[model samples]
Structure formats: C-alpha cells, structure tokens
Target chain A: MSRHRARRSGLLRAVLSLGLLVGVGVSGTMAYWTDQATVTTGQLAAGRLDLTLNGQLAGPGGSTTDTTFAVGDLVPGESFARAISVGNAGTVPLDYTAVSHTNGTLGPGLRWTVVAGGAASNAGSSANGDRTGTCTGGTTTFSSASAISANAAAPTPVVPARRPLAAGASETLCVIVRLDPSAPSSLQGATATATFVVNGVQRGAP
Target chain B: MSRLRVVVLNAGALLGVLCVLVAAALWVTGSRPLVVQSDSMAPEIHAGDLLLARSIPAADLEVGDVVSVVDGSGVRVTHRIIEVSESGAERIVRLRGDANAVADPDAYTLSRAERVTWVLPGVGSAAAFVDSTPGRVTAIGIVAGCWLAVVLPRRRAPLHARPRRRRGIAPVLVGAALLLPAVLPGARAWAIFDDTATVATAPLAAHRVVAQGQPQCRNEGGLFGVGEYVRLTWPHVDVRYEYRWEARHTATGEVVRSGVVQPAGGRPGELELRSSVLDLGLGATTYDVVVHARLRAAPSWEAAGTTTQVRTSAVLLGLGVRCA
Candidate 1:
C-alpha cells in the first residue's frame, strides 16, 4: 500500500514538472516574438535630407547671379550678391534658414540681404525699400530674415525667415549686396559668405 | 534489490539509445534542404518548391546539368552551364538560368577553388521551417522528451510498460527522403577545354589616337568582320572571339563612341551570341584616342535550343594625341 502511494505521488510530481517546463518555454517564445515585431515596426518611421547649392556672385561693391549645385564640392567665397537655389531631394520635408557668417567687412557702401523667391532687381535694395548702410572702415553690417518665398514670381527681401519645405521641393534665395565707395579697397575682391541651415542643421561657406 | 536495479538500468539505457538515434538522424539530414522563395525559375521550377542539393565534384558536371552554386554573397543559384574555359591552370565556368534571357554578369572560374554539384527539384521548405523559431522549439521539445525518458527511473513502470521498440526512425527517414531531390546527382563527369589567350600588345596610339582590330573572316570569298561571320558552337559552350581597334584625337576623355555589329546569317549558335565592346581611351591631350573590342558568347544548347540569348563586353583603347 505504501509503495503504491509513493508511486502515485512520483507520477503526479513528474506531470507537474513537465507542465511547468512547457509553460516557461511557451512564455519565453511569446516574449521573443513580441519584441521582434516591435522592432520591425519601429524601423518604418525614419528619414533623411540631402542638400544641393548652386551659383555665386561677387564684385568690388555687390552683385547677384543664379547658381546650380553639383555633387561632392563646395562653393567658393569669391562670389558676392549670389543667387542660391536649394533643392530638397529627400524623403522628408525641409525646414531651413539662411544666414551670412562673415564679419561685416564689405566696402563702405556694401550691404547684403537675402531675397527669397523672385529676382533681385536693384541688386542692393530690399523689396521693402530698405537700403543697407555702407562699410565703416573694415566693418559692414549685413542681416538676414525669413518669410522669403522662392515660389513667388517676385520675392520680398527680409532679415530672418521661416520656410516649410515638402520633400523634393526647391527654392531659390537671392543674395543682394551693395558696396560703399568708402569701404577698404581690399574688400572689393573678398568672398562673401552664406550659411545654410536646414532642419535646424547648419551647413555652408562664407 | 538486484531485479529493481536491473529494470531501472535497462529503462535508462533504452531511453539513451532512443536519443542518440534521433540526434543522428537530425545531424545527417537537417542542413541540406532549402526552399524556393521566388518564381524566377518558374515553369521548370516554382516558388515554394523544395530543393535538395549536396556538394559534388565539379568535374562531374555537364553542360545541361542543373547545379546549385553559391555566389560571392552566399546566395545559392541553380542554373545550367553556358561556357567553360581554362586560363593556365585555372578552370572557369559560366552559367545561366533557364528563364533568363542573358547569361550571368561574369564567368565563375572553378578549378580547385569552388565547384557546384547537382540540384534536386522541390524540397527546401522543410529545411527553411527548421531554421525558424517555432520549428526550433519543436525540435528542442523532442530532444527534451527523449532526455526525460532516459533520465527517469524505470524500476516502477508508471501505469504502463515502456514500448520495447521506439518509432524514431520514421520521422528521420521521411525527412531524408523529402530531401533526396537535392542530392541525387552525386557523381558525373563534365567536358574539358583549353586555356584562353591574352592580347599580344597594348593597342593605344600616341596620347590621343587609338586603333582597333576586328576578327576578319575570308571564307570561299573576300574578307569580312563580325557582321559577315556566323560562329557556332555546341550547346552549353562558351566561345569568345577578340577584335581590336584604335581611336584618334577625341576631345574630352568623357566622349564615348559606340557601334553595333550583328551576325549576318542565322546559324545554330547564332542566336546565342552575346557581345560587349570596351573603349580603352586615354586622358588629357587634344585627341583622346581609343581602341575597342567586343566579346560575345553563344547561348546554352542544353535546353534543346529552346532559349535565345546574346551578351557583350567592350574596352576603350587610348588617351593621347591632341586633336587641335
């Protein structure tokens, strides 16, 4: 009778052990699968941006011209009053701002402002009729603004601007400048600087 | 005490034997099967079909033989031989799939390096499944069960007697039989060929002029180049004929000059001709001379002339001689 009872208990213990092992195995497998699924789905929401710049303008005073960007090279600073067209050929929208990083050292009458969307007619005057002052000694004051639109047939000039870009959209920003006769003679051939800030990221040359 | 110990030991031994058998089976037949995932080889093979393949001797291969070869990236491809050649002591073979209209990008040379063996029809799906997590778990469970049976005490037969013979052979044999399609053509002999020759000299002219040569044929009549000759070789054979030329006074190094030469008469190996021309052009100087040659291959005859294909290779010749 005792032997029979002992055998019954052993059998029950074996069955319970087997059940526990199966339960642990199943739960582990389920956890692993869940983690894998999450990782795969999380990878779907990422993107990147690519920027291209074209053309530069420079002169004794100030100048403007259209430009195109090519792969694997930077624009020289010799160009003044340049027209920069930026293209967004990436999968994400581009939020960008343009700034001049050079010290105010253009000629006595030199001033630089960005004209977004549209041609620069006077080359040195803002659409709002603002004329920047000339250089005092070696120092010239140039400012930039947003709200310039490359999509407009005629763009307005501003100091700081905000622009929203859809993927694959492009905009042309015109650099307008004026050179003062009182400015240093060496300033005539110096390279103007333009800094491109896209999606809060800064890149460019002065 | 003796009787009880004997019973327990016997049970344990039997369980151990069962485990070893299962393991041996899995070890032998587990890794050789593969599943088809694409319809690229349709008509002759389809997606989801199983393929069983085993490593075999390259010398045993023939032109029409279907073989599975792993490429540089480790992806396996099953195709028929289109050409074979030897360069010095090195043996090279070119392959193309039945469904493809063109041969592969480059010839695969296998001397003592690497070779492909025969391919089996459909049988890779199970192997693919076994590679997955769920299948792995099942396999682990089977192993654990065998282990448990071996480790448990058998002096007290739990309610029922353990079967005198375990049926472990069935699953293993079935698995191997399923993979048999991948391994049937174990031993076979293939054809041999002579080594290919290289050009005798560089064919560039000055810094800007290039001269080219074309293989001219003078049969019963006058001489003619590529358009006049109809070269033919047996099925599953690759034949290359070289032509040379030179160029003169080309402006920019980027300038490319292209032309096409086709076979004149339809011949048995005519449809299989593949051609490519290379401009060996030189840089700088006024005239960038270039000499070009075309390389062509015949289609595989193993498919009983069912498929027609052509391929080409080109080279530029020179970089000197100012045009202005």
Candidate 2:
C-alpha cells in the first residue's frame, strides 16, 4: 500500500507541474496578444463644389466680383449680342441658372434672346445706318420679342432651364438684345442698363 | 530522480517548441497583422487595435467588406467597400470610412484586396514596434543570445551538472521571444483614405446699354407776309426726329398758329418749317415763335429749340405789308 501511495504521489506531482507550465505559457501568449503600438491611417477629407463664370468663382448667395459688361450706342431696328463663358471650376459636377434685370425707359423697347454654342459677331450697320449684330453657330434656347418693363427690380430668367455642368467643363452662351422697330419716336437718346447673374449649386442626390 | 523536476522541464520545452512552430506557420502564409490608426471606422473598429488580414481575389469582394488597398504611392488604406462594380475585365471598388459622411473621391481598381480576418484589441503599438527593423533586430539578438545561453550550456555540461532552477526557466523565455516577431510584423503601412472636394468663391457679372443725341436750329426767314421759315438740324444722329412750331400773339397771350411736323422724308437730321401767309388789317402785329423737336429711339430724348423773336412793323390794307 505504501508503494502504491508513493507512485500515486509522483504522478500527481507531474500533472501539477504540467498544469503550471501550461498556465505560464497561456499567460505569456495573452500578454503578447495584448501588446499595442501607435499607428495612423491617412486623413479623410470632404469635397467642395465651385461654379465659375468666365473662370470667376461665385461667392455666397450666388454673387461674384470684378465681372461686368457695358454695351452702348444702340438704335431702333437694331440688335447686339455677345458671348458669356460659363465654367465648372470645382471637383464635383454642378447645375446652374442665369438671371437679368434692366433699368431705364429704353428697357421697354428692348428684347432679349439666349442661345448656346454660339459666337457673337458684329454684322455691321444696316441700310438705315442702325447698328446690327448676330449670334452665329448656336442653337436658340430662349427668345422674347415682347417688350419688358422699363424698370424691373425683380430679375428675369435669362435661361429658365437648369442644366448640369461636368467638372472642369465650360459652355459659352450667346446673349442678344434687340430694339423694336415700332418703338415710339419719343424714346431716342435715352440709356438702358442691365445686370446678369449666374448661380450654381452642388450636384443633386445620386 | 525527482519526477516533479523532470515533468516541469519537459512541459516548458514543449511549450517553447509549440510557440516557435506557430510563428513559423503564420509567416509562410503571408498573413498580415495590421494596426488601426484612425477613427474613420469607429465603434466596430478603433485606433490602437490589431487586425489579422488575409489576401482575397478582387472579384470575391462584396459591398460592405472592410478592405486594405495599396495606392500608386505605396500607401495602404483600409476602408469599407461601399460599391463593387465590374469594368471590362477589371474590378472597381468604391470605399468609404464608416465615420465619414461621403464616399471617397477616387475609386480603386485592383486584382487583389486584403480583408480583415481577426481583431485583437489594444495590441497594435507593441506589434508595430517589434515589427520595425530596429526593434526586430534588437529583439532577435536578445532572443538568440538567450537561446544560446540555454542550449550551449546544456550541450556542454553533463545532464546532472546543470542547475535545476535555470533549466526550468530557460525554455519559457525562449518560447516567448520566438512569439514576438510572429504577432508584431503583420502590418507595414495602414492609413484612412479621404474624400474631400472644395469649391472656390464666385465672381460678379453684369451688362449696360446707352444712347445719345444732340440737335440745333436756325431761322433764315423774316417779315410777316414774305418768306417765313425755320430750319432744324441734328448732327451724328442716326434715328429720325419730329418737329413742331407754334406762333402766339405776345400782347394778347393768344395762340394764333400751331403745327406738328411728322417724321418727314428728309436728311436723317434736318428739318425745314414754312408758315402760312398772315393777314395784316392796316395795323402792326407782333408774334412769338417757338419750335420743339424729338426723336423716336431707345430711351428717347426731347430736343426743343425756342425761337420766339418775330415782329411786324407797319402794314397797309390788302397786300401792302412791310416788316423788319
């Protein structure tokens, strides 16, 4: 019985030793697994949207700076036109529109037309010695022959349709203004001026 | 022989060998251990966390799978796939950080992508340091030295000559050192990708129009019954103009004559006015003459030239009338 007891004690001791060693190994593995180091992933940044007219970006409320047009010496039965550049200067695509407002008595006799993909060219004077011009190489999008208000505070839509402009893309608009031949003779030698503003916003929901 | 001591020694050695073999297997499989570095994928994943990543075919990737891709600059970015599409034979993947509001600006085209297989929280820093060249070299040198201390002494010294305490601890130390490089060297470069797009300020635009006209007049005719006329001229004017004349009796404040000259066929800026013969009943009569002109054009202007200086001296009956 004593011999059997001695053998049993030895086996128990071996098992205890193995368990202790296994416990130590597990603890070490846990420590290594829990080991940490500092690392960084590159920063994630947000995108921006910019719409420009003639390479000029728009400010808040769809306003821009240092851009204006001046046309003069207009007469009855004559028309004048010019090309305005519209560009998308941002990284993302955008949609835009144009509006105009005129002041002075001559405004009532003036008619406006807008066409895309056109070039403004002076067509020389007519037989009656009146100034004349044309918008060549274009498709007319909007035109109105009826007289507008003499002094309109509210802006009139030059291009009622809103179109999407791809990033870094540019479009030229041929804007034409004509004086009615039937305008009353009392409107001579007067002046009329107008302002054109183009507004743009980021691309719509995808 | 004390069985306790022998058992302890064998168990330690066995544990050491297992650690070394496991480390070797991980290295041959090309598995990477990556450390999280940004909060772009927060909540589910966090900074300072360690991940075990495995290589997968690009075609096998699906939307919402977290992946790590190397860009042209050799920078590796880990993000979640928001979209997966095929372009010809190429695979295109669009990714975004979980914490970001928008997807990345540029899509990734790849043949293979790394997908995370396991995550060990808060073990990234240690693994990164150990995996680095300096850290790895230093650690390997220490481990090698420790291994030599244990093995060399055993080979040289007789089995009974070695110290009992030293034999019991040496294998455990060797085991831990071998495990160092296995867990720490999985990641080389990991970063969070950005999706930023900025817009510049817009400028102002406007247009203006104008028209101008000037007119002048002259009186060449005199006397009450002889030639009485006024000529109007406007220079540098292209549009047509209308003129009117009125003859008033200055003493009686009565308008005796008034006529409107409609836009007549003439030179663009010239007008001639002739008056009817006046009746003189043996008395001298004085009259005021006034002329007004205007043009029909855009934003028209009024042009009036007043000529109220006509007088009659002595007049006999019938057709005998003289004036100055």
Candidate 3:
C-alpha cells in the first residue's frame, strides 16, 4: 500500500509540474505576440522634384542676360545668337516635351529657320509679319536657329529647341536671330516670346 | 490526518498554481492591452479604454468587424473593418473608426498572426502602472521572496492542527507568480510569416489647390462643392499635393489627358487658386479623375507637443466637359 501511494503521489506531482510549466510558457508567448501585433511595416512611398536653370544670352547691342536678350538698330544682314540651357534637378531622369510660340513677323528679308543636327526642323510664318520655329535636338548643339533679314517685310522669331533632360543632366541650345538692314527699321523693337514645358512621368518601383 | 483535509488542501494549492501558470503563459505570448490616450476612437472606446486585441488570420475578418491594428507609426488602434481583401494567399483588412468619416491612411494586413485577445476594460491603467520602473522592481522582489519561501525549510506542524492545512500552498504561490508577469504591460512578441511581395504601379496625377481654413471640396457631376472641413490642426506642417486628371469617353471607356499637376507652394497655409483642367482632345465627354494624395509629416518628438507637424491626405475630385 505504501509503495502504491508513493507512486501515485509522484505521478501527480509530475503532471502538475508539467502543466504549470506549459501554462507559463503559453502565457508569456501570448504577451509577446500581442506586442508584436502592434507593430506596423514601413514602406517607401514618396517622390520629389528639383529644378535648376542655367544659360546666358548674347545679342547685337552687347546686351546679355540669363537666357534673355534685347537688340535695337541692327543694320540689315546683322544676326545675333545666344545660348540657353535647361537642366534636370530631380533624382529621376525626365522625359520632357518643350513647345515654343512666337507672335512676330516673317517676310522675304526677314525669316526664321531651325536646324537639328540629327533631328527635323519646323518653321511657320504668321500673316501678322511674325514667324515661329520649333526643332528637336540631341546632345552637342541639338538645334540651332538662323535669322537672316535685311530690309525684311516683317520681324522673324526664332524657334527654341525642345529635348529630353536626363536626371541631374543639362542640355544647351543656340538661338540666333537675323535682321535685314534693307528691312524697314519700323520693325525694330519687335519682341518674340518663348516658353518651355518640362514634363515628368512617374515610374513605379521594380 | 483526515483524507478530506489533505485532498482539499492539495486541490486549493493546485488551483492557485494553475492560475499563476495561465497568467505566465499570457505574458510570454504578449497578449496584453496598452492604454489608448487619444479621442480618435471616442464613443466606441474612450481614451482610457483598455483595448484587448489580437492579430489573427486576416481572411477570417469581414467588413464591419471591430479589430485592433497597427498604423504607419506602429501605433495600435481598435477600429472597424470596412474592407477585406485577399491578394493571392495574403489577406488585408481596411479599417475605419465610427468617429472617422473616411477609412484609415492605409490597410491593416495580417502579414503574421500575433494579435490581441481580450480587452479588460479598466485594466489598462493597472497594466500601465506595472510597466513602470518602480512597479517592475516591486514585482521582481515579490517573485524572489516567493522563491525563497519555497526553498527554505519549515518546521513540521502537528498532524491534527488546523494551521497545517495550508502546507500545500507553495504550488499556489508559484502559479500566482507566473500570472503576474503575463498581465504586466509593455510585453512584445512577433509572428513569423511571408513578406509583402506585390507592388502596384500607377501614374502621378494633377495637383489641386485647396483653400486653407475652409472645408474640403468635393466633386459632383463636374462641379466642386464645399464639404467638411479638414485641416492639419498640428502646427508648422506644410501639405504637399499631387493629382491626376483623367477624362473618360463615357460611352467607350476611353481614357484621355492624364493631366499631372506639380504645384509651387511649400507653406503651412492655403495659397493660390490652381485648376486641374482635363483636355478633352476631340469629343465632348464626362470624366472622373480620382486623386490620391499622400501626406508625410515630419514632427520632432519633443516638438510634437509644440508646432511644426506635417499632415497629408488624398482627395478625389471630378470634372465634366464637352468637346465639339
């Protein structure tokens, strides 16, 4: 009887101990899991844009500005050219389309032409004695404008170059306008406006 | 000694030990509530409510189920599920609060299973207290005392004495010790699972200028109407905006002119009047442009109580036009 009682007591003690240990383990794990469940996963989810402008203008009257120019009293057959630059300041490469519009005149003695070293040139004249030009260019003088007008019927506006700007990269274009001395000086001080558009297409993560 | 007395004493000790063991299990597994200190969940759960939550298989959840989840900051929240989705084998749940008109910033996904279990209403305050340094030290001292009491030898009492009835108490004491740590606040555990693998790619949209201090604008049938006021009540935070304008050929489902707007302002207050126009290239058509805005705030921890917090949001606006 004593042996049987001792064996039973030992068994009960073992079972109870095991149960206590298991219960403790589980409770601790539950607490740990609760804390873990409260954590969130962080993700990369934002983008930004940066911009910078570079370039200088040179004209017949020795006037210069940052991408702007003014010339007066140019004898017919006189031409001036300025350099303009556009740069990409963003971390991603930018594929952009640059469009230019003009509101002046173009005639026999006064006309504008655009030349792309490796691309096509676009030229158009307005009935109001104004002409607009557009052209696509690549690196290294992608596009150039030639203005030749001496006693031209109207003032000629040069088209600006449109191109792509790689991330952190810049491209420059040569803009030249010509005046014909034979062209009536009445067309003097005629102004041409040029605007450039830079567009970026957002890309998804790989 | 009477058999009944011995049996009763042993049973009581066993029960006490079992309770402690259960508590210890809960502690080790990290199934405890941390108090909420904001009114964001008001009405349903107050700022002081003890939120008992557990992470389970997201697939098991349905819309309208109240669940506790972690947000972008790793802060836990108890909200109602508004959307449930399964992409492949992964499950995701979108949650919103009864007090919030819109869904949360993003979806809460169960990438792993270790979530909350039960919320003991007012027990959060006690849990919070136990999480403090002094409380932890006191708990450790009690546990050490219990250990000493069990290991030390005790004089044998008279077999027929009433006080001898408590001799089987060591097990009960141990069980209570185990349970104490489980209920302590600030316990943490993680679940192991597969990682997030899919990415959704979409084009950027146009920008919309919002007038500060006024209500947010909503688009209905091609017109903007004033809606509820939404502001970055937190000071010194500038909101960044991005939008996409899409016009569909209502009859053909053809999409045109994904106008992307990049605004030029970095101030805290509302500035200019900017419009995102959809170019209906050839034919007149009605279009819906869904705008998703993501705002990131950069507030210093110390300055959090002060000003200069950042806030961001995405709103959808609609436009209608005819092309001849």
RMSD to the true structure for each prediction, in A, is 31.5, 16.0, 29.7
Model 2: how far residue A72 lies from native, Å: 3.0
**RMSD value for candidate 3:** 29.7
Q: What is the Cα root-mean-square deviation between model 2 and the actual structure? A: 16.0
- How is the predicted docking of candidate 2 categorized under the CAPRI scheme? incorrect
Ranking by TM-score: 2, 3, 1
* Per-residue alpha-carbon lDDT of candidate 2 for residues B44-98, written as tens digits (9 for 90 to 100): 7766677767788888888988887766555566788999999766679998778
* Interface RMSD over true interface Cα atoms for each candidate: 25.4, 14.5, 21.6
Candidate 2, residues A17-131: lDDT per residue as tens digits? 3432232333344334533322332221123455566655443224343223444545566777777787777666766666666666677777888787688876765434365
* Candidate 2 Cα errors over 4 Å, as ranges: A1-47, A58-68, A73-78, A103-110, A124-129, A145-154, A179-193, A202-206, B1-242, B249-282, B296-301, B312-324
Residue B271 error, candidate 1, Å? 58
- Select the stronger candidate by DockQ from 1 and 2: 2
Error of 3 at B83 (Å): 2.4
Q: How big is the positional error of residue A152 in model 2, measured in Å on the Cα after superposition?
A: 9.8
Error of 2 at B129 (Å): 27
Q: lDDT value for candidate 2? A: 0.54
Interface RMSD of structure candidate 1 (Å): 25.4
Best by TM-score: 2
Candidate 3, TM-score vs. the true structure?
Answer: 0.30
Off by over 4 Å in 3: A1-206, B1-19, B23-39, B42-44, B47-54, B109-117, B150-324
Q: Look at candidate 2 and tell me the lDDT of residue B24.
A: 52
Window of ten residues with lowest summed lDDT in model 1 chain B: B193-202
Q: Which candidate comes out best when scored by lDDT? A: 2
- For model 1, state the Cα shift of residue B20 in Å: 8.5
